[model samples]
Target: MSYKGPEPRRYPTAPWGAGDSATAVESGKLPAIRPIWDVHIRDTIVCLGGDGFYYMTGTTGDNCWAFNDGVELWRSRDLKTWGYLGLVWSIDRDGTWEKNWTARAGVPFRALWAPEIHFIGGNYYICHCISGVGIGVLRSTTQRPEGPYAHVLSDQPIKGGIDSTLFEDDDGKVYLSWGAGQRIREIKPDFSDFAGDWQDLAFDDSGIDPKAKKNGQPLRRVGFEGATFFKANGKYYAGACNKDEGRYSFWFASSDKLLGPYAGRHEGPPGGGGGNLFRDKAGRWWQTFFGNDDQMPFREKPGLIAVEFDAAGHVVASADQPFKPFA
Candidate 1:
């Protein structure tokens, strides 16, 4: 666990017996997400896996901030010291994903873009993506991870869907990766459908490379499209997000199972054009994407960077070590 870069004194403290609501970490710093919503924010983040920590949902503000990103900053059993569980679900007319499918699609889907909060089988789904439709799944019947959820797929229409992502795997199966820009699909386990056909895995236009040409042209296929898949050691990684060079980049590919012949994939600029990949369980790798808030100064601010991967995985971003959510 020693790639050592920004020690900041290895933040995270509370050990001794841990509790007082335990929370520590600020060494070389690197953990600051601030903004928990007050208005105007979109597609920020949506990580989920609770009971042990990690729940970052998005789309905050408007319609009385319906679920306002469901705001709940931090919590961790071991993702490092994070202890902030504030806002938990809202927008109700009777619940059921806000009174039956965003009020019968009459508008006000509020905060439902990439919500993803899965616990599966035993039940706890929450896969979202709605502003115009495409993917949805919100069942939590009860076992609460802060949910009043229960949308059971929300009717239909998922061809080139939104940014949804849900995976179960340990053998129970259940997969559902979305599509927005680069297209990907694999949902079927009664999650209501979609599981065969729709796998464009980016790098298209015939995956150009006219001799690595730059200004001379050739090398098009740019489209990472927010894909997601995970598993370590046993391998199966697939992380994406490439906006065709307009500035959102991150990429990854690997396989050993879960459909993919992906092996040793590559992209441009030491891997920014690649899409983000943040693996942790000790393998220690980080890669978050998105840049250009159009010269900051408050232009809606959108710039996140965290790079560091090497062990042959290439990307070694100047030894990045900022995201220390808790040592």
Candidate 2:
């Protein structure tokens, strides 16, 4: 099947979808991330696949407020030009079980939301949130990035929460985290079920509530979500976003242990668009996010920014150009 959406942009240089044009037009040194045309709101998960290609995914459902479509799968090599792989999973895919719960809970009307894709155990596993109650898991047995991933959790194993994140530790243990001050769960080896009880995280909270309403107007939300946890410098850092409150900021908290006694901090400027902070194959770090909210018009464009560390160990994200000037 083929997708008819935003064709990658026609750069000043030449040719659309022609031979190696993306890599050939590289802006070397800095992390180069261009718009994944017609894509929006999907989680920005950038990881190098075991197959020697760089991969990423976005929630495609962001357009539903106006378009009514659901999630679609995507992959890229140079992080510039992206391919609309296929719709591996969606909320309205014929007889989706999520329809049952959404109809009952009154949230089914909401479009398909935040999704995450990861290359794990030589298999590609993806997770999607069911309104904010739980998450559905999907798996692809094949070796390709554009997966015909099967829903592993049609019944849905996540006990609760949305904007869920799937994380694998150094020991190969997988954990799921989401919502505000969410619990982290360890998944069984087979990815068939969640193991044991959920654990609470220790956060040195400084962010505001993203869902808070004021006297007459809704206050800008600053509460945390999109908790992308990863290991670096031999420690675990929970990289997450704080939306609205003033502007979008990517905040992080670090700890020696996987579950933490942590202090959270936010990156400024190209702040605003909440995203995932991940490392590429060459050891360089980058943060990828979409332009959202009144940040519409910019809805279909996703931006990538370079992240660097200071001598003091602070992660300073470069949000200068190409990236919408938010703050």
Top model number, lDDT:
2
Error of 2 at 93 (Å): 3.7
What lDDT tens digits, residue by residue, belong to model 2 across residues 172-195? 998877765346888888877778
Q: Write model 1 residue lDDT over 1-327, tens digit each, in one string.
A: 111122222223212211221111122212232222222333334333545454444443433123233423334454434454644554343334333334323433333444545666655666555544456666656756665665664444343356676666677776666642344556667666656766654332233344434676633223335556666566665665554323344445555765655555444222132223444444465443222222111111112334454575534443343532232
Q: Could you tell me every candidate's TM-score relative to the true structure? A: 0.29, 0.73
Model 1: how far is 59 from its true place, Å? 1.8
| lDDT of residue 287 for candidate 2 | 70
**Model 2, poorest ten-residue lDDT window?**
8-17
Off by over 4 Å in 1: 1-58, 62-110, 115-128, 131-155, 159-236, 239-303, 312-327
